[model samples]
Target chain A: MKKIFSILFVTLLLFSCQPDEIPPIGEATDYIPMLTGTWKLNKFEQIDADAESKSFPAFATVKDLTNVFPGHPYTDFSITFNPDGTFTADPGSSYMQMLTSGDWEVDDTEFPSAIILSSGSETQTIALNSLADVILGKVEFKEERKQADTGKIKIKYIYSLSKTSEL
Target chain B: MRQLIIISILIFGTFVLKAQDALPKFTVTPSEIDALTENVVIEFDVTGTAVEGLTDVYIWSWAPGLNPSEMLLCYDQGSPSWGSISDNAKLEPVAGQPNKFRLSLPKTVTRAGVEVTFNNVAELFGVGDTPGKIKEFGFLLRSQDGGSGGKQTPGDMKTSITLLPLEFEPSYFRTFPAKVSKNDVVTAYLNLSLIESSENQKLSVSDAFTATVSLLDENGTVLLTSEAFETTFTSEKEHAFSFIAEMLGAFPEGKSLDDVSKCQVVFSGKVYNQDESFETVSTKVFEFDFQDYE
Candidate 1:
């Protein structure tokens, strides 16, 4: 009995030493570098909307973009952080004007790339697949969704960012 | 036991994710603004971590007290928000896209102390929230005095006179003929127009600004002096203000002055603002052709 208890203790110790099982090779850390610049949403789709098609030509190709979100929609937006603590948003193609000015704070963690924006009411989060994607600027992952009848499903969204503006 | 471990791992992962999701760093650089003849331009740039879903840019005109609508020229379309003015030339992804924006003053008026805002809605609300699909940003644009002084020509006041023949039949406004015979009782009509920007500028019609009318050889001076006039308006552009100088009399009762061709309409006026110190003298002369007289 004592032998069995000692063996159990050793097994538990080994399990604790191993790193937590990380999600599939999704978003990564290097993704941050790729996302360092402006990214216009040339294409987007409504996966849950009661529409037959997934993609729609609703938003125009945004050249004056100032921000982007990796995963979550409204809360995790991009910003061109200025020296004076001020920032600019990518004026979206929606009828509403894009580009907002404000301040921002980031959460340096592993899974949820959450950044809080100050200066306005909007707050958001972006989930990356891995540390590599965070520094690379391109994020590919499946977003989980629940259908009214089907219950749960995952929708995929890909983000490719570039340093569009030097100024 | 396995389920418990999975739950703990997920919770710990969430905590770590929150820590990594901290604010992406950034900075704002002051940009130069050009002073245009009709308006002013404010420009700037944002560099650092990419903050997404931002859509509104604000400009705060810092001049004497001004309305936001009057101060803000372009922004994201939300109320008090306008769309971007630049084209797609700078937004190409392959091209290093510079997130640039500009604010301008109205063309009709000039002012100082304007502040431009390039803000994400989160910043505007001061919540420090994540920028969602509808992001908002603002820039504080302060106007600078490249010190371009007032207009080159001061007191740009103008006046014009149209002499129409008196008409018996009329539509909306009374109509008038261009010429009339000496024996005919002629009622000459005059219309005046003025353009003043400031209240200090005034358009006063005095005997000095009146024209001397004379029929060929009418003995002494038959010149008539009309009453003086002044005008102002609620609109900003050109305005029409009129003063009629009418001279009514039978051509010397039955004897028409000889050489009626000498009959003429003279116009005179002096341009002066509130301060009577500066004045400009202007005059226009018109002649009546008796051969074509009614």
Candidate 2:
């Protein structure tokens, strides 16, 4: 009888002490090397060409114009970042296209990493979060704008960017 | 007789163990995204069939990828100060802490979804020259039985900063009188109304949003300049400013608005904020054109 009681108690304790189930691993890492490719800019039909077009497509993605309003014209640009610090930007079905070649660098000083683009006459800095290469995920984009009459324009867009075949 | 006593004890122990498993859950009340010019207290109350197992409760900023350093500007000191249940109104800041604010969720949170109020006050002046943005606020409860403190929580259950639209309404105006003369004060008004999201999507609109207004003559020479005017007014909240050009100042002494060869206005602005654990929302820019004054 003593032996039977001890065994029963041990079994009950083991069953009650079971741990909670572990969640799936969903944390992401950075993608700094997946930017190497030759991209083809996509073109789109113009509805009202008379209206100052805000966004254009390139490198299989839509990116904004440097001179246009913040996030006004959703722009898609196909860009290839090589290990040598050179890049080729193509349009992704965007009629308004800008195929510019330049260098890019990342700033990790702050929490959300920033990428500064040195395209010919213009210089731009893009703040990025949830950065992953070759995988399709949502990322937050941040940029700063200085306007005349008003004050300043700080634009933020939450979009998905997946790694596609080189353009 | 010994056998019967052991059986009775076993039955009683089983019931007690089952009852412990039925402890009450915790819940946090939802709040409207209100605004204030100074520090505001966010109150959260924990009540209901209270449980005694929970060791501690914690509050965290639910927004992803925000700069921990920049967020420090929003708090009164550096951390969140807690008061007893009577009045959670007066909030003090925690000093030299990375997280913006924190709260204790002792075993007090009994019922599931316990309603709690947290005050988030707004201040007119910011830490430096910039007023940090208010992205979102939320809380997490932990069992504290040697488990992952707040990271083990399921989801972010709290209020967030709703992404707002750019305050860009582009329009131009020209002034002309029947009898035109020199040195006439020609003023133009520009209004920018900030926009926010409907679903409470997190957005940062403090120092991130800015406008640059300039006056250019036909020669492209800047007549007047104003850059980095850090300002934000909610949707339908209009901010008005006037610009005057001295026709005589541009050219010779006798030159007036009519005498001026050409005049024009250019306005540009953009908004930026952190998005996820370490990323930011795609940057946005807005531009407008005004009548050029000669």
Candidate 3:
């Protein structure tokens, strides 16, 4: 009985000495290397302040919220992130389509992380949920606007990007 | 030598023209004030040629640290002290006050720029209101259709003044059952206490005060939202009120309850006066991560 008691005490001491496991808040290390390269849109999710959820195809031609592609559906659409902190989106192979280019940066200080993209005077800050070498997921910040005729509305958007090429 | 002199003359002429064409210098007298009243008397002046073409001028006033969302919530609930702007008030010189004019803001102003400045300004707070102490006071000037080629300043043109010699007392809050386990039905409770600047003025509770809770997943998507709970303070001495938020059942879509990344709780409180007029006292947002729970 004395030996069993000693063993149990030692076991409790060892368990108490173990450090607490920290939940995966996503790796905070520099993501510039993993961020550079070509990526294709894989999934899109949008949720409004009212708790309404909407799912869209990889590249849809809808005009309401998922209108990344103006007139044409986003089939085989891809965005290339260069090493110099610049990015360009492929507007398909059509000549009439306009090319979209912007600047991108990652902010690791904020929880869920954030990636700010600026195209001209308009800028959008996207909250990163999970990020890896091959997979990237993000949720757009909430936007609130008041219509002159209607009242007020709040909207949020989320996106998933998959690595396509390293070059 | 002759060619050099000619070039010098042309350069000087161009420089003079540009100086004359620069945007007018706008000024606001008594730039800072110690106290705010229902009607604030403001002075405006234009010292350059651009003043003649000035179609309209407006003034925007508000307390610093108040965000746009909070201001809008206040406006929706009828609290006017967050900030406000004048609606294209006619800019005529003061009768006996010289450049000083009686300015009244139609609504609250949120952003800068002549066109964007007039929209979304909130009303001002006085001695009896919550957060009566002013830390940073902001004043802005705008001319209609104003720009480099027009009558107004080109960019974000505004001045911020610091109010001195004032004490501040913000609302205090506390929460219960600050932690929860996965797959457990939990009720989050919150307590909020009000503050009064003067002893003579009593703080009355409004029925519109509510508290709401939201559970978000790893993707910052809302997994569940609790119904907003209504609350009211019973007495002035015991100025604290409490509310409960209930989270029921397991999360949908077979997602593990432990995967919830964050929880947000928002408390919107309002107070009333002797005449039964109520205004939003405060709107506070609190965010908790999974680690905050036991």
Candidate 4:
């Protein structure tokens, strides 16, 4: 009985000494290092707010969106996340061809997680569906037109991004 | 004999006074306005004599396609005239008496300037939301209690107004080497011209301006970009400028310039104020093909 008890204690100690499983990129406690890089859009889709909800494909490539949506002024169609928590983004093509610079923060407390970006007086929060070292997926929230009788309409946009460069 | 002569003079003088009372002299303030303004407030003041028998106010505007002289003939004959004039030219009574009317010109008028004529007519045309240009405008005042149901009445007064012309059209674009050869160095040239403003004012060359050139692939991807070169208008002629881009340097690994099936040169100009706080002027995109330079 003493030998068996001693052997069981030794087995538990060995198991505890082994390294734990590594957490995913965005799920890790220290996730700031994983986000410092240039990212390009890969897919964009929108889910409508309706009883019978419908999913619509918005754009697949930079050129397709520019042609379909005239007056889109962005050319590079990319976002660069810097080590200092600053970010620069080309928000597609527009009449102004303006590039937006802002600050970003990751919120890991939520069920899925979220990334908040603030530019000037505008702030946008994107919910992360999945995150990895080279790929990131988020759901964008939008409010459509409101109906007096039916209340307010809302939509969800899914965005997938791929890492293009490291900083 | 002296009494008879005095009586004749008094009768003639009375007729002349009646004629003067029928006509109302008009004064339109701020005759000029910026070309891009959406709306303009024109104040109308009647001088000379008190206007009586005023009923309706009629306004007509003319642009490049519309003829003011012909429109006047239509009004005189009470015919459906101004075939070329768009319905966007509108008039409303804002201040003074209900008889004192205000003309609400459309945004199109400011972009291209128009001529407007105003008079008092029995019929009133409805206003419109469409955009249109007017070079001259005029108004007429008429009275309901006039001869032949106001048709033969000469009591209505008329006058004309002018709009400032646009300083420039969108933009004229051109490029060199409409085609491209592989591995060749690319050089781009751009030119812009300034036109007279609504105030008949010319744009100053000393104004701070920047010209930027961008090279985009068929996928609308920006492969290369030139610096925002600061330049000034040196001549009234096309403000000529140029920039160079290395074609081979823009290619990715395992690729060459030949892989670029299609490319475009986009040139734009913007004018800013002294402190760069205000961007007052900007040109539309001037996109052209970026051919390979042999």
Separate DockQ for every predicted complex: 0.01, 0.02, 0.02, 0.01
Which docking category, incorrect, acceptable, medium or high, applies to candidate 3? incorrect
Candidate 3: tens digits of C-alpha lDDT, residues A1-167: 99999999999999999999998796655567667788765544433222221121211111122332224333355677788988887856311122368997776533336667779887766566566433352222222322224342323334456777876
Ranking by lDDT: 3, 4, 2, 1
Error of 2 at A132 (Å): 6.5
lDDT of 3 by residue, B1-294 (tens): 999999999999886565445443443334434333233344455443333334455433445655431222123233433233224334555565443434433333332232322211223432222222345555444443333443332223244445443322233433222232232222233333443344212223434656666778778888877666555443222222222122333466876556676777665656776797777654445676543221
Q: Estimate the lDDT of model 1.
A: 0.33
* Tens digit per residue, CA lDDT, model 4, B1-294: 999999999998887676555544444444554323444555433333333324344444323334333333224333435332323333354565653555543322211234433221101121111112334444444332234344211322235445454332222443222222322222233343434343112233324555665555667665655556544333333443433344123555554444454444443443456787553454555555543231
Q: Which candidate, 3 or 4, has the higher TM-score? A: 4
Task: Please provide TM-scores, in order, for all candidate models, with all chains considered together.
Answer: 0.20, 0.31, 0.26, 0.29
Best by lDDT: 3
Residue-level lDDT tens digits of model 1 in A32-98? 3344454333332222221111121222111111122222232234446454445577544332123
- Name the weakest run of 10 consecutive residues (lDDT summed) in model 4 chain B: B122-131
TM-scores computed on chain B for all candidates:
0.23, 0.27, 0.32, 0.38
- Judged by whole-model lDDT over C-alpha atoms, candidate 2 comes out at 0.35
Q: State in Å the error of residue B262, model 3.
A: 38
Model 2 docking grade = incorrect
Q: What fraction of the real A-B contacts shows up in model 4?
A: 0.00
